[model samples]
Target: MDQDSQLLQAATDFAYYPGSHSDDSATEFLNRFPLPLIINALQTQFDVPGLESALVACLERLFKTKLGASLIPEYMPFVQVGLQADSQAVRSLACKTVSCLLENLDNSHKVAAHLIKEFNMYPLLLDCLINGNEEVAAGAIDAIKKLASCPEGIDIIFPSNKGGDTDLGIIASQCSSLGRVRVLALVVKLFSVSTSAASAICSLNLLKLLEAEIRSADDTLVTLSVFELLYELAEVEHGTEFLSKTSLFQLLSSIISNNFTDSILRSRAMMISGRLLSKESTYSFIDEQCAKSVISSIDGRLQSLDTSDRDEFETALESLGQIGLSIRGATLLLSGSSPAARHVIDAAFDQQGPERHGRQLAALHALGNISGETRSENDIILDAEAEENLLRLLYEAASKSSKLTPSGLFLSVLQQDSEIRIAEWEL
Candidate 1:
């Protein structure tokens, strides 16, 4: 190895320090190669190929230790300079280091406050977010998420009172479609931090950006990306309630209801609708009619699909399972005017051959959910006719030994209520 390679290897060894090393070993390592000296070398040796990344790996591993983490705040100037570096690699490394700094710090909030207020790093980070390569942008996203973990950081991120030059909405408007998608992703990240952050996003009407993307229907890929982010937001705590007030549900309903839209997009819309209604708490915030409309839209979409549209067919079943996770959702699916739960039943028992196995599995899962597998017997949401269908299937499974090839049906039958089990036994 050359001089630079040897130096990097040595730094890696000490930073990583395999197996159990005592405090004395760390002190010895630090005494031999002090953290500041390494930081200085990193800045001065920026031109060396592979030196930046290797040293960054060393720094990240070192920061995992208490000794290295304690010195993070002291090197804030280095981070600030690296953030502004002309080299995209250096900027990416800097973003990662900012995350490393906050992650290891005992008082992350105070240090994040310092970075936002004193160092004025948000704009630089935002620049990385908008223009950097994939790794750089990802690092910037993580750093920004850490910054938003505290109250003061939240204000800087969201900027409640006025739209600054650094406001996400302004940045999004100036960006290309791709950049706008990145901004939406960042918004989702920020929204995941706390209810207050979610409220801030709503207060700023940032979700309108997502709404606009979905409604535009100009680009299938872009709209799909927006739906993915929407699905992510739906999975966050209390996310359904937050989305309830928006026109998103109605928009998704229309997409699912429309025949000309991309089947994949309609499938995504169906899943999002299911997720939004998965929790009962969501019902408190959403209108009953809106929920019904979403379910009906999905039901209509399912009914329109022939067996050849296997992807949409399977996804619609899975979406119904998500909705059936709750009692009201199960009731809506099983007892609706069109009765979408029947699709789940037909999918479970009607299909044959290995080609249709996935469809059957999805149906089995939906039936399990609707029958309250995770809930008590009193909580099973299937109505009388639906319940009767489920029992009849169980009884048929129990009576006929020839019908157990798709073991999922037999397993699902076994997972039913004790009363149903006794009835199946008698049959």
Candidate 2:
């Protein structure tokens, strides 16, 4: 019999083999089906014009047989072909199969090396990263991670967004929240592995794009995902440097201003601000323009807070404390803005409030951080009543618990040392 007929007979015979058959006999019989037959079947199953389901079935059976890995060399062409499959299901299955093979780390590396030599796979994979369904995109990311250490792979995956005019801009614009989340997750994973790549990606304006989406997206999960990605990116070396750019600061201000009711987004914004301020260099670049934007955002939120908005307002106040600590330009924020401060303070002290004490405490801390004591003579405008009220609040907070003693101590320092007060409070 010819090779095809022989392979078909072997497949039929193997199906009938008893479960208790001797290992040696079973191994020998299974070995009778050559690697080429398995490779051809996988391709023919998936590559035919309208036989994607059949292809998936064939691959599933082959995967069950545990013979796919052994035929990696013969399957390489199919992988390349599958990456560009018109049907998302077929492409997704291809990615799954590749990921399954990659479970063997050594084999994964070898496949990656082979893939590097195939130039088409790199761009095709990038396209998958941008437009594929979540499963397919996730699988593509897994494959890229397996090969990320390869120079060619890194080169392919880490290009500047401006390198070539492609559809990513359009895709990013029209992408669903699920698609954006998957793409952001992949980009974040890549950043975790290589700081240089992270810096490059950041400079390419990906963060700005994500920040725009965060401002407009009403979906809590999508906002949470984007915020988490930004938080992760900020933790990288020089990550904050990118964030300190004017565009990013403006975007952040816009998001803060939008003030969606999602607690997670509020908390995430607080976390990101804290991390970005951890770098001293990043702090200096947040100039007066950025400060005005942030202050405007805070003012807008304050005006929107009613009894129903208590939870969201309190979360925003906590974020304000974080912002006060990190942003050097914070002193300029809310200056001559008594209405905004009064609104926030009123919410903080509201009876039966959602986060009454916590909100008051944070606002008090922020007020101390940005008061007029440190401002130049021309810039200073002391609000004696506000200062006295802050001190009273601190005293009350200190009475409530030993935990607030430091807040009391800081308040005393503000009262006693004019220099510390001037530096923090001066715009």
User: Would you estimate the TM-scores of all the predictions?
Assistant: 0.85, 0.57
Angstrom error of the Cα, residue 244, model 1: value is 0.6
Candidate 2 lDDT, tens digit per residue, 216-266? Answer: 767777888788888887777756555666366666665666554455565
Task: Give Cα distance to truth, residue 138, candidate 2, Å.
Answer: 1.5
Per-residue lDDT value at 336 in model 1: 36
The residue-by-residue lDDT of candidate 1 on 274-389, one tens digit each, is 88888878888888889888988888888899878988998899999889888878877766334777777667554356677677767777777877885566786466866665
**Cα RMSD for candidates in order:** 5.1, 10.6
Error of 1 at 251 (Å): 1.0
Q: All candidates' lDDT scores?
A: 0.78, 0.56
**Leading candidate by lDDT:** 1
